[model samples]
Target: MRPWTLIVVSALVLAGCTTTTSGLMARSNDTEVKVNNRNLGRDLSLSGLNRAMVGGRLQARAELTSKASGDLYLQYRFVFFDATGKALESATDGWQQLNLAGGERRQISALALTGEAVEFEVAVRRIVDE
Candidate 1:
């Protein structure tokens, strides 16, 4: 089937259907993530996907900047959907550590759901692991 891709905003990563081919889509300056609760900000919305994702090999292309160097972790989650735009199931992966250059753009990748993955959703959370 013809594939579609969506961009997910993360200070913490979540699950669902979306595709990201490394160098395929460039930096998306159109959207921004900010936590409305406090000084911490990370936004989540739909971007760069045609008609949303139902199921397939979904991936998220995120550009993140670490507040500090050393070792950092990224949390990701995914949501699945049916053909009629209904939420099927949601899955959240644990924190994956990633080393950053303090002020650098890092692209995080995921395999998403396979086989019967018609459409999907995603999330990302920055870990403050010491």
Candidate 2:
């Protein structure tokens, strides 16, 4: 095979390995939660997130701040996971709405419905207006 052809083939093979995996991946306790702010203003950001055991159940709190010149609408949810990395089934864990004015900061919190939750992840996304 030509040298250039061999290099191109190897590059294609390596690129295929970068595809997303469907299986569960191990996550560390120090992993930072990712928030999708694409549709929101650039001045909005997630400041902090903290998780703790409250009343024998998992409790999560997230702080959001908006430095924009207007109000920002968004949605957030808490996904609880057990020690084995399985997500806990709970009907109450649904997307909740949030509104933040310019230069405003707000803290949102959620409690696990059961004691089986050992870890939690918070996801935030901008609410697109129709």
Candidate 3:
């Protein structure tokens, strides 16, 4: 009757899921993306991320440079940590593409953490040679 229909539907759903589960649980491959060292200094260092206050939600990576002063090939990844320095929650281990011209520094691009993780680490990579 009604219970049998529910069971039949559930069985079909589980059966369908079996076909795609082969690679879904596989671990993500490790990647090494180089961070642009020359573009980052104490003024625009990763540490700056620690000192600044992020408004809104997760900060969007900065993607443009102003006046063509200098260019920044930036890639950012976010890792959230609790107040005790232990990783609070995990996020996908992938890099995001971002670009900023040499002198474009007025843009407000940054992401904020959503959970109780109080500490964060951001890696900025230089996509183009400085």
Q: Note the Cα lDDT for every prediction shown.
A: 0.41, 0.70, 0.43
Runs of candidate 1 with Cα error greater than 4 angstroms are: 1-38, 42-56, 67-74, 78-92, 115-120
Error of 1 at 4 (Å): 54
Local accuracy of candidate 3 as per-residue lDDT tens digits, 1-130: 9999999999999997873211001001222222333334421432223223355233333222333455555555565555566654444445556676555453323344554545454454445454
- By TM-score, the better pick of 2 and 3 is 2
Model 2 clash pairs are none
TM-score of each candidate? 0.40, 0.69, 0.42
| TM-score, candidate number 3 | 0.42
Please report how far candidate 1 places residue 50 from its true position, in Å: 10
Leading candidate by TM-score: 2
**Which stretches of candidate 2 lie above 4 Å from their native place?**
1-28, 31-41
RMSD to native for every prediction?
A: 15.7, 7.6, 13.7
Better of 1 and 3 by TM-score: 3
- Prediction 2 TM-score vs. true: 0.69
Give lDDT tens digits, candidate 2, residues 1-130.
6999999999999987884322112222655534333435366766567778888998877777786988877777777889998998654577788888989999978888889998776666667668
| lDDT, residue 121, model 3 | 49
